[model samples]
Target chain A: MISVLNAGNWAEQYSTIGERAFLSITMTVVGIVIVVFVLTLLTVVVSLMSRLINGKPGGKETTAPKRQPEAAAEKAAVEPAGSSAEPGASASERASETDGALIAVITAAVSLALSDSSQPSAGFKIRRIRRV
Target chain B: MNSIVDFFNAFSETINRLWQGSGFTNIQLSQIGMILIAFVLLYLAIVKKFEPLLLLPIAFGMILTNMPMAGIINMNFYDPDFITSLGYPENTIFAYREVLNEGGLLDYIYLGIKLGIYPPLIFLGIGALTDFGPLLANPRSLLLGAAAQIGIFVAFIGALLLGFTPWEAASIGIIGGADGPTAIFVTKTLAPHLLGAVAVAAYAYMALVPVIQPPIMRALTTKKERGVVMEQLRPVSSTEKIIFPIAVTILVALIIPDALTLVGMLMLGNLLRESKVCERLVKTAGNELLNIVTIFLGVSVGATATASSFLTSRTLLIIGLGVIAFGFGTAAGVLLGKLMYRLSGGKVNPLIGSAGVSAVPMAARVSQKVGSDENPSNFLLMHAMGPNVAGVIGSAVAAGILLALLR
Candidate 1:
């Protein structure tokens, strides 16, 4: 409804009902055509953007990063107070999972300590971490 | 004794002037009627809780404008007749000092509406607030958005058959899009006279989306179709989110330049929100700036409901046509949904298509509610949101088309 120009000559066209009806029907068709055409084109554009950004609808980003944190967290949460569930699992595997757990704990404590700041991670530094 | 009689006569004359000048005497039956209508709207907004954010200011502005001889709203200033009376050519520019000296406050405020500023700004806020993720997840929902716009044309034909000019008919037809800003934007430019009637009708029906949409939705689709559960949308990437507004703005602007203002500002706001770098600007645009514009917009727009303009048969016809527009828009969306249901081998729920009318979360919520009633497990809100957001673009595009052809 943002009219680009003032209503100059456009007002008061087609005085007769028959003429107006014809104009309306014509405008209706034009309106539908342009609207559908524009949005359908937009749909294509958005779809193209999606493919470019994500590579595929649910590609590597969807499958990889989402599961790693949860799997690591579950292992860390479940293994600490009891026997490790998987006898076939390597010691390095347990150590790797525990490293993620240690990172989460340190980050949490730093986040809490700097909670007064708008960005809690701004001041603190992890410096370095390596397996002992 | 003659001096005493003279004093009494002078006093009587003074009393006569006071009586003539006071609103108590100047109040016309039509003004009273408009005031009563304003009161009824207030009741609806307060008691019925129908879009009070805009309605409250609008109804108050209505009362303020209708007060006899208050001159709070000199709508005459906008009339061609009044412009001519001011000793300038009807379309002359640079009447600034004259208008500032002669016009009422509401007349000045109405400039924002007349020049098409507020609605697009409101759209900027809407864009900042809207998430196009649902829409991008399912691009085909755009068709439902496009299909729903058939109602605008249907209503246009209805208005034309009823004897409205093409310009006025186009203004009324946008009510079918179920987007208030777009409706006001069109009506202000094309048929500024009908702004009040059209705005009232548009907002009233928007608030009643839950009531009006469900019946049309239920009637159009079967129990099984309504019960169909849509799949969860894919996880949209941040990059996709950031790119969407930019892409839409470019495409829509290139094709429909008339749509650029409303659509451009909308996409800019969305871009700001999605970019995540302009939080302060987004907050102001979406929250504080939007609130200020809404107040000004509702008040000035309400003041346009002057007795002479609003109390006409044409106004009533516009209102009647508005509901019809809403109904047609909803039914068209659902009918298309049913068709999609068939085409997609029943994987699609027809209920979500009704959200294509752009009532935003309201239509989407109705879809969810109706679907849940049919089957407790179905969650159509996200799926419905795809079409719901697309309807915003669809309706804006429709308004642009109407403006392009008619204006």
Candidate 2:
């Protein structure tokens, strides 16, 4: 084990070199082990924390209420006058509301154009559009 | 005619006095060489944009310190004999009184580094900016961070073989951590004499991460492994993020109290950022406070590299060892990544392993670049961030262990 640890014969080169080489090898092995151990412990701790906080293991979807796409589309159709100055509404909420209304308007225009062309617009569904 | 002659004599005398005290006459070849090195650093910072924020100030400080008899810095503070003659024991806390009484502007600036206040404050800024979500999502990435630290010990042995004292070797070894603040913090405590060389080497190598990591990363991992795609990270809750820093601080403090100053300040900064109530403080810590400390830290650290201390063969060896340490660290992280890849049934991309050297976003970007080369659609940036941030914590832990053993 000693020879393996000092494989490069670093200890043999100098009298003072032996102690430091030994210490370095020991520290290296021990340091790597400790880091791994601590981090592993942290991993387990964090996993537990997430599980406890979210009430489920990793990757479980949250149970918070979300507005469905259909509901959003209906709201957009009914509220053609557009968003009002709602209290405590975030910028993202306002933007998303505006986006739903714009999408509804565009879909209506596309549908009207297709009906006027007198061609069947089968399997034509607008899923989403994102800026590049 | 006599009055005119007297005026001429006085003029000549004044010119002679100016020449005697001027940098032109007092400068040596060594000082000139240091000044030229400083200019090169300035060019690298300005033109190439190599870690410009810190390097620019450092290069400027080097220029200020090397000018002969400028009285910008007191080199005597670094002199051991001089420190002892001032009625204090060797290696005691820095005598700020000595610097306050006899030193100049640079000396006052250097006190931040000498008193070991700058690195932790820098860590505070880093903590505010850092996102631990990726790391939290994939806890196993922490092991890769640990594996990356093999380079530090590899260099420690190399330095020992090359005849650096244990303390000096520890300081040199930390350059492998690829963390400028950690390297500066450890070197300041262990070997202040080598602080200038170590700091420059750490930051320079960090800037060269894109150049240094790719070859080693490619050499260590197979193409198939690099092409592997990782699953997207799960969203982390704000509560988890807030608890993380506190838990880590408490654990590290209990385990290694010596690391408390660096680790504690880092966690505190992170806590402030994660808590969501201290936006003003977080903004200040992350921007204004950080900028101020970085300027003082860089210039003062650069000023320490006077001609007498910097122009030596040892500096060359340190620079060489620093590269070796960084390369070895990259290799080790990749190799461990490969191991984990096999263990996890190819879920992990080995390319992200190279990000374990604590160069933060740079190492992570290199991982992304390498992965994209193999497959253009492969987005490893967010995935690689897990190990990259973990490497920061790992290096701090390693530094604490070294300080505990060696100090």
lDDT for each candidate structure: 0.86, 0.86
Angstrom error of the Cα, residue B212, model 1: value is: 1.0
lDDT of 1 by residue, B272-358 (tens): 999999999999999999999999999998998989999999988998999999899999999989998998899899999899999
Interface RMSD, in order shown: 5.1, 5.1
- TM-scores for all predictions: 0.83, 0.84
Local accuracy of candidate 2 as per-residue lDDT tens digits, B1-407: 99999999999999999999898899999999999999999999999999998899889989999999888998777666677888888665555677778788998888888888999999999999898888887777788888899899899889977988767888999999999999999998888889889989999999999999999888888888988977767778899899999999998888877778888888889999999999999999999999999999999999988988899999999999999999999999999999988988998899899999998899999999999999999999988998999899989988998887767
Pull out the clashing pairs in model 1: none
Kindly give the stretch of ten consecutive residues in candidate 1 chain B with the minimal lDDT sum.
Answer: B90-99
Best-performing candidate as measured by DockQ:
1
- Model 2, docking class: acceptable
Residue B201, candidate 2: how far off, in angstroms? Answer: 0.6
Tens digit of lDDT per residue, candidate 1, span A12-127?
A: 54557776667677777777888878877877777777777766642112323456667866786768643554434557678767887888888888788788677645766675
